[model samples]
Target chain A: MSPFLLLLRLRLMEVFRVRFTGFFFLGLPLLFFALVGVIFSSGHPFAHRRVVMVATAADENRSSEMLVAMARFTEIRVERAATHEAAMGKLRAQIVNAVVEPLSDGSGYRLIVGGFDELFGRGLVTALPGHVELAVAPLERWGFVHYAFAGMLVFCVAISGLFGMGYNMVRYRQNLFLRKLSTTRLSKSTFVAAQIAGRGIWSLVQVLLLLALAHLLFSLPLSLVAALWTLGLTVLGLCAFLGIGFLLACFIRTEGLIYDAISSIAWPIVLLSEFFFPADELPSPLRFAAAALPSTQLVRLLRAVLLYGETDVASLLPGIAIILVWIVMTFTMGRFFFRWND
Target chain B: MGFGDQDALLLKVVIAAARLTKRFGSVVALENVSFQIEGPQLICILGPNGAGKTTLLDLLEGLSQPDAGEIRLFGTPLSARRYPRERVGVVLQKEFILDGITVGEYAELFATIQGVKGAQQILSQARLQDRAKTPLSKISNGESQRLFIAAAAVHHPELLFLDEPTAHLDPGAKLEVGRLLTEMSSEHTVVMTTHDLREADTLSDHVLFLVDGKLKAEGAPATLIDSIPPAARGHGTLEEAFFHFCAARLTARGDIEPVRP
Candidate 1:
């Protein structure tokens, strides 16, 4: 077998022997999601939740007035769909809670099957003279639990990248474990690859499980497309985060230093993220700055696919591009400066 | 074992380090340290503490780049791209094993890195088969040391570099490690550094004495012993030999006060 396989196997055995490592990754994020989900699901829900819906009509002018009248609620957000078929596609994809189209007689609107509160949709139904049709029942008792879950999922991945792979490297180097591997036939690339692959496997498994748990707990909806997109985005995000961790590990020696140093980078990304507040509510001065953080990008992109059913390639490119830059920058710097021993 | 593009005829030339110099900022660790090994010889780098023994070994093992020198293994220059890694085993003085794994897992990891099998056989040779499943942290220091030796020697590399294998061991453990090194010398060329004079005297077929980053003397133990004058050879052990070399290097460098008449 290749040394990479051996290293990965041994690492997995070593890490698995300590169950706490796996649990720490799984438990903390699940708890965070549960706490938030429970608070929102029990009674109080988020106020004026922004809902994206696609409106289509034969005449653009008529739909414009309907959009104007609907904008009065401030809770409902709207998007224009080019056709009834387009609106139906978004509604089916959960991109929109419901489609507001002209009635058959073109006199009123009809509420379609959706995953939003009936009462919230009622304001539109009463003004538009439409009846409610339930296709997907409410997944969340209050505000959408999926958005909060996305942030918590990002938290899990960020911690895993920053601490799991990076901290372990520093510890191994300090304890002379890496120096031992260095003398063997183990090449630098193989060693690093093993770390990345192994940690990625562990992180992906936990994240998927957390995804499933979110579905079961709050009745959150899941689809193959959303799960697959989360996987792709997560893998990209992981590479960037792991690269950052690796570069940091190349310099820092102590475990305490690894914790403090990485957390200093990750916590800002998390704290300034929607993790602490709804994305729209981040303090105004820091809103743009927070949106630019890798964690924010990850959370936003993850939220798009998971909750908004946004798998649009063009819309995701900017965030993906920024993450691509991180992946390139961190791994390049890390590979350049990494030493087998401190 | 893999010796990519290495000449088969020159395989016996295990190592040839010429004018090897290494520096740490301003402090010189090893200076102009030249040496050669042409057979499966048990070589000892005998030195006093801080005599650059480990530094020389690091240079030979390709762990650190020498500031000014070249090292050739099997007639191939030691570059990261071309070093005969498959034919070498190394156990650093400050090396450590991941403690969270079983001893078997640790040995298996080494075997896998070298692309060989028989971790069980290695553990058996180390008398650690019974403790294969035991976590590395739970093993005694002696067992840990034996495992280190066994794991490195598992692939039977042409050469093995050990740095102070018996430094912190108790007498029995040291003796056991000494026996292990002796057995290994028969099958593979072993280069080890130590400040323990008796251990060097008892274990090495050839000895290299280093003092203050310089090769003071080297040859068969008998040749070194014979070179010392009978009167100055008090008990005539490697201890006396190393002290003799240390004194000579100091005198040659004018690093010591002139001896009073």
Candidate 2:
């Protein structure tokens, strides 16, 4: 066999034999995708419907008219509570979006809202009738998990390259396989190419597994072009992430240390990349920072393909350019810092 | 089966070093070290801990560079930038092969990397034929070392560098590997590092004793052993000779403490 084939075979064998790697790198991501899909796939049940508390005392006629109007609002669902205390308790529990009651001062009815800034609460107050003073609480963004499927796919690709290749490279270094190889006729370029090739092969397998699960579990939309673009983006994303992993491995000394390093790097990228929820609500500067991350661009690319069935390569030019730049920069940095011997 | 017409004298100098010096930060790892290995022989580098023994092997293997001086392999100057690494093999002190692969697979990988043949013969010579199917992680440490030797020898390198090859082996396994290495010496030059005086005395055709980053002595083990004073050679063993030599050097350098009582 050629050295490249031998190296790739050894890597695949190691990936399967090491129980932690096999399960965590390949199996866990599919499990996460399924679990998220099942939890959120039926669409947000209450995202469009607002739970409201109606508390009226001694003004039966006025309260009845107001309740009728509130019920007529398509986004509002009115729940009547017998006492003001009960209504406020439900508001504290977040069971109701806003609480409404007659004004104790008799000038007007005051709305007691929970969980939102007073500025936004004032808007709801003005939007209601003159006799109604409105308070409002924040609502979670609806239909987020629908897009979450796309986000998780990107997350899986990024972390599979980071954690998987990071550990492998660290093991090769700390265990002295790298040093031993250095003494052979094997060139450094061959060794590095072998590592990337091994990772590339495993990453393809992972993508296929995740896609299959997504189809079976969530009925994810998978048109032919969408699938092809997803595959292409996934490969590019893996290349960028593999380069990042290599750079991290060069800086770290031991396999054990890579866990902490990967977590610290992955969590921020995952959270900021809008993997689970949109980072749209974040401040513009912060969102801009998130946009600069490779994961963010990758998530955007995957979401376009899987959610919207976007398949045009020209529309994705900017994303592709960013990912390519990341690959080149990180790979160059990794080669600069790489050391074959300790 | 061998090409015998080539002049033996032309290939006599397998490795040469002159005034080699290496430093790490403020610590001098190797200082003004010079040595040579001629033809196929077992050369032992003996030293106490942190005495630059492994450093020397690393330098000669082209894994590291010296702050000063030069090294030549096969009569040509060796530098990491353009060293001809194909003619050499290395077995580290630790078990460094991939643990997930079978012994046979590991040997095959090394063979493939070196672009050589006969992994089966190398495994058999290392006495690992029966364990060919075993995972490296499942084997005992001694067995792992032997398997590493098999992998290192897969290329039939003209020069083999082993860093403390028998450091962790049991006595029986040590002797067995020693015998194997001695047998291999007739075909290729073997250079190894060890702290075991007995093993060094038993297996070495020539010994290089490094102390505190300096070459304290060099010669056949018997020559160094015979030079010890009769009173100092209480056991008539190399260990006693090594003790006397270190003590004598320390006394001359004013670092040895005077005996009391």
Candidate 3:
């Protein structure tokens, strides 16, 4: 066998030897996809506002007619109010989206709004004539499923970075394994290539397993081509993060310091990456900072490809560029600072 | 031989260092050091702690570059930019625990690195045949040391460098390792550093002694021992001679720090 291949095989085998390594690469992604699928499939009833019903004794026929009209435009549940006082009581109690009060003249009506259902009230006013004005309490859509999946992807990357590359390299240094390898005919470039190849294979396997589970159990719409693209992007992301791990490992002398440094960098990337929220909603400085992080780009790339089916090269340019820059910077740093002496 | 005929007299001097110096930003590790070792001899370097032993070994092993000096191996100038692996074998002071590989597997791996066929034969030579299936972590320290030596020599290298090969071995294991080194010297020049003067005396054909990064003395063990002060020299023990030499060097420098324990 060729030297590179031999080293690559040994490295690949080492990655597989660790049981948690398998989980980081495979189990976590599968769980993440499954959770996303389940959450998305089980849509929330509260997401759609129910229509409100209002009644008064002055014009029962007019009130009923308005209730029926509101019901056509929203999810309205009709209720009777003997007087204006009773309708005001129902409004205060927020029993309905809005109440229609009949004028004593009987030519028009006033829609008394309640806060129980803000979305229905706005829809009612928009669908009705100009005379009706909406008093709306803004309700934002819940995108928990998207946020959760993105968070899980970021977590997986962090785990792979910390345990897969950072911890492993530190232990190797502490045990003098790297020093011993330095004595051999193995070049530093070849050694690093082997490590990348090993992690690449493991990360590929993980994405495949997750894709399969996502399809089988969660009914995730993972096309064959989409799956392949996800796998490729995941491997690229893994390599970039692992390269950072190696760079961190180079500066720290002891295992304890290595752990501290890796964790310090990793957890913040997780939070500041905005994996759990839309980047637009995140604080401005945080959004800018996260834009520079590889995880943010990776999550964005995965979401675009998997959730949105955006496979065009133009759409993927920014993410690909960020990942490429990260890989180059991290690999260069790792090679420059890595020492066998200490 | 005249200085002009120095190159002609040597039969393949695999390693030659001249005016090699290393400084770590102000602390001098090695100062204007010079040495040369021709092939097919077992040479041992003796030094105490912080005596620049590791730095010198690292330079020779191609693991690091010297700050200012020249190193020539196999008639070619050496530098970090280009590492020539065909002529040299180095057993570093530390064991490389190649993960997910067994003892035999590592031996085979190194055999491939050395471009050697018949890895089993090399394993037998290192006396690690029985422990072939054992994981590297499962093997004893001495066995691991032997395995490293075996791997280094599998290619039949012209020069092999070992740094403290017997540091972790018991008495019996040390003797076994020494015998293997002695046998290996017939075909390959072996250069090793050790704090143990007795091991050096038994296994080395020539001794290079370093005192504070300088080549304090060099010669056959017996000759060096006989030359020591009469009151200090004892029963041909290189250890007694070494202490006396260190004491004399320290006194000459007007420094009173004791020799490393």
Candidate 4:
């Protein structure tokens, strides 16, 4: 057998030797995709709003009609009150989005919105007559499944890449397995290539499990070309991240330092990568930082292929370029910094 | 296929170091060190902790590169580009954790790396045949060390470098390992490093004493021991002679700075 294949087999065997790691590699992504499919297939769960209608004595008829119209556009349950005081009490209890008060002149109506009901108030005002007034509570948008999937994917990649490469390389070094290999006639390039190939193969298994789960439970559509691209990109991304992890192992002496640095690098990458939201939606500097991250490129690429069925290499060229640059840079850095006999 | 006698010698000089020097950020680990050995010679490099013994072995084994020197094996320069991996075997100090892999699996993997046949024969030779199916984690420390030796030698390397191979072993295991090394020297050039003077005296056909990053003395163990000053010789032990040599060097150096006093 080729030296590369021999080393690759050893690495794969090592990865599977860790019991929970095997479960994590197979189980976690499946659970994530299943949860995403379930949640998104339904709607956003934490975004409910209530709209309230209040009628003044003079314009009671007009206010009632406006309330009914607003009800058609939302899940609003109307509560009628004889006085404005009673309407205010309902608003305070957080049971309403807006209280509509009819105008004394009988020409228009006024809608008083609760402090916590912005979406419903906005919907009511925008969907109602020109003379209608609205007081809207501030809106807090809850993330949906698309957002959740993006976040989970970033997390999965970071956890898998960091611990997988860091712990494995350190173990190899501490055990002198790498030192023994260094004594061989095998080139450093071949050794590194075997490592990347090993990680790529393992990540492919993970992606397959994730995709299978996505298909069965989430009804995730699979375009042949898109699926292939997603798989390729995932492998590429794994190589890049694993390269960084190898570099971390090379530079850091202690396992504790390695764990700390890995987590420190990983958490920030997750928070600032814009995996769960558009970069434009984040703070300005954070958005700029996110745009430059490899994770961002990977997430964008995966989402495009998996969610939108865009498999054109031309469309994915930028993301692919970013990930490719990361891979080359990290691999080169690792090779440069690695000490064979420390 | 048949080979001439000259062709046989050509295969015997498994390792050849020419002016090997290594530096770690201004501290010289090895300096102008040159050595050559042929198969059937069990050579021991004797040095204290910082005497550049491990450095020399590492350079010979291709684990590290020299700052200014060359290493040649079988008349070809030793390098990742020139040498095939199966040609050299190395046993390190620390034992590797093969995780869930059984001792047999580890042996087989090493055999595969060595590109060899008869892995079972090698396991038996290493005296690990009975425990072949046992997990590596369950193996005794001495057995682990033997397993490493077996794995390294499975390919029947042209040259072998063992760095303190018996450091963690019991007395019985050490003797067993020493015997194995003696047998291996018949087919492979063996270069082993150790601080254990007894091990050096017992196993080495040629002793290389390194002091302060340079080769201080070299000869057969008896010859080197006999060369020591008469007053320092006691029980004619090689260990006594070694300490005598090292102590005399330090005392002579110490006297140079105290001339006025």
Fraction of native Cα contacts reproduced by each candidate: 0.91, 0.88, 0.72, 0.59
Each model's TM-score? Answer: 0.77, 0.71, 0.72, 0.68
**Candidate 1 chain B TM?**
0.89
Q: Output the chain A TM-score of model 2.
A: 0.59
lDDT per model vs. reference:
0.75, 0.75, 0.72, 0.70
Q: Over the stretch A164-234, how does candidate 4's per-residue lDDT look in tens digits?
A: 77767887777777777776555678776777677677778877787777666655556777678877877
> Cα lDDT for residue A80, model 1?
64
Q: Where does candidate 1 stray beyond 4 Å?
A: A1-142, A276-289, A311-322, B1-12, B248-261
For model 4 the local lDDT of residue A148 reads 47
- Lowest lDDT sum, 10 consecutive residues, model 1 chain B, at B252-261
Model 3's DockQ score: 0.40
How large an RMSD does model 1 have? 10.3
- Tell me how far candidate 4 lies from the true structure as C-alpha RMSD in angstroms: 15.0
Per-residue lDDT tens digits of candidate 3, residues B50-160? 778888999888878899888888767787777677767888887678676898898888887666784797689878888889888888887888888988887777889
TM-score of 2: 0.71
User: Runs in model 2 with CA error above 4 Å?
Assistant: A1-146, B1-12, B97-99, B225-241, B248-261
Q: Which lDDT value does model 2 have at A123?
A: 59
For residues A21-109, write the lDDT of model 2, one tens digit per residue. 66667776776566445434534434443434445457676667667766767655566765665555445434445777777676666
For model 2 chain A, the run of ten residues with the poorest summed lDDT: A137-146
Distance from true location, Cα of A159 in model 4, Å: 2.6
Residue B186 alpha-carbon offset, candidate 4, angstroms: 1.1
What is the per-residue lDDT of model 2 for residues B198-218, given as tens digits with 9 covering 90 to 100? 888889999888877888778
